[model samples]
Target: MTAPAARSLVLDAQALSLLLRNDRQMITRIEAARRTGVPVLVSALTIVEAVYGKTDTARLHWVLSRLQVQEVTPADSITAVRLLHDAGDLHGHKYAIDALVAAMALRSPPPVLVLTSDRDDWRKLCGDRMQVKDV
Candidate 1:
């Protein structure tokens, strides 16, 4: 038979923050994806970045209501650490959250699209494993 359809879209912190801020483009993209029955995913690390401050509790809740939050599992954490190490040693960059986001996106099935504002880092970390949609 045919292979299973690819899964959801992953949102990085910047993209999620844009959605929280009600950016028209991001909202429109999310709405269009929802219309096509594709759910949006946000890594736990991304949530940490987006809701670091005490303000915007209501806004955080609203954003959460619109997307699925994927928790960082032990395996994901290990992979993230490895990614950080590799990038730091090779590219002179140490980005924990971005690595975690990449790990989460890579865990998903093929054809996964990651909505991100920082395209370069994600591109370096993910390579050709997933598609990065710059926002």
Candidate 2:
């Protein structure tokens, strides 16, 4: 049998909420990721948003189980901080959490991609540099 393919994906809070609510687009992406065996990463920032109790712990675990959950680290934090302050390029929408997620994806093994609903923000900073499939 052939070995499973490896994949890396970044999930933002909105995407997480979509996943929790059984949104079709979110479900499709999740299925695609599962089919590709790509690891899905949920940023700590998402946890902050999820702290609102909108997410069920059981479902969260299910989401996490679909792929690896890479914790957002200080290095990720530093990248976010830099991007947020990079007023020269990032423009108005380069928020802290997006930077961290982008940084984390960039630092991950090459070929990682972000599955997000917010394309504008991802497009603004990543452009063609990142592997992004936006909704």
Candidate 3:
């Protein structure tokens, strides 16, 4: 069988951190994905999770310039709640951002790959709708 193709790439907080740090491996992966026309995405909420006061503003802006920052719509927020509820009532602050990320990924093109450290959490949130690859 042919290798599975990735249509979109979603980066969670951990992966986004690595990318912001200019990690060689992460950069290579992102470049390769871009070369193939895969949209590298970061949820607008992920900015809240990944960026902080100590972060380098110049680097942050530079990196963000290269990726797609997906805005969270009102409908997406509703979907995020449903995802949390569906995942066995996994509500509360801890799961809220992840649910949003999963919601965004679910609405993206198929074969969506999420680079995250929380593999199990993403799997639970995304179900069979998207792929979770550890950062």
Candidate 4:
């Protein structure tokens, strides 16, 4: 018998906020991933966007405890800059944090899934490289 394929989940800012707000759907997906031993990831930029200007330390701690936070490496930063430039050319604007998240998702192992509220932006950024679930 073959083992199930390894899977990982990347959460965007809106998805993280929904999870913090105790949204049933996001909670269900996150808990299901946890049960299946799938690593739940949050980009550093997403963390910034999710928790910025928040005064609730306890809630922030709780949210932070739920997922693995991934930092942008030097390589990721370079790629993100390029992605931002490309997005600016393509969409007439830049989504810096989204580009960073997409870059991180691109480098993750196969079968990666992204939970995002901005489906169109992520789809454009990721370019069919990963599965995107709308939150």
lDDT by candidate, in order shown: 0.79, 0.69, 0.90, 0.81
- Among the numbered candidates, top TM-score falls to 3
The sequence of per-residue lDDT tens digits that candidate 4 reaches over residues 1-135 is 743354889999999988877889989999998998899999888877876565377887887898898988888877877776666544333477788788898888777888898998887776767888788
Q: lDDT by residue for model 2 over 89-134, one digit each (tens)?
A: 4533436567777877777765667777667777665665567766
Error of 1 at 54 (Å): 8.0
Candidate with more favorable, higher TM-score: 2 or 3? 3
Write down the TM-score of every candidate: 0.84, 0.75, 0.95, 0.85
The number of the candidate with the highest lDDT is 3
lDDT score for candidate 4 against the true structure: 0.81
Taking all chains together, the TM-score of candidate 2 against the true structure is 0.75
Global Cα RMSD, each model: 3.8, 4.7, 1.3, 3.5
Superposition error at 109 for model 1 (Å):
2.6
Superposed model 1: Cα runs more than 4 Å off: 1-6, 52-55, 85-94
Model 3 is weakest, by summed lDDT over 10 consecutive residues, at: 123-132
lDDT by residue for model 1 over 3-63, one digit each (tens)? 3444778898888888888889999989887888887899877887876565378988888
What is the per-residue lDDT of model 3 for residues 1-135, given as tens digits with 9 covering 90 to 100?
643788999999999999988899999999999999999999999988998788899999999999999999888899999988888989888899999988899889988989999998887777868777888
Clashing pairs in 3: none
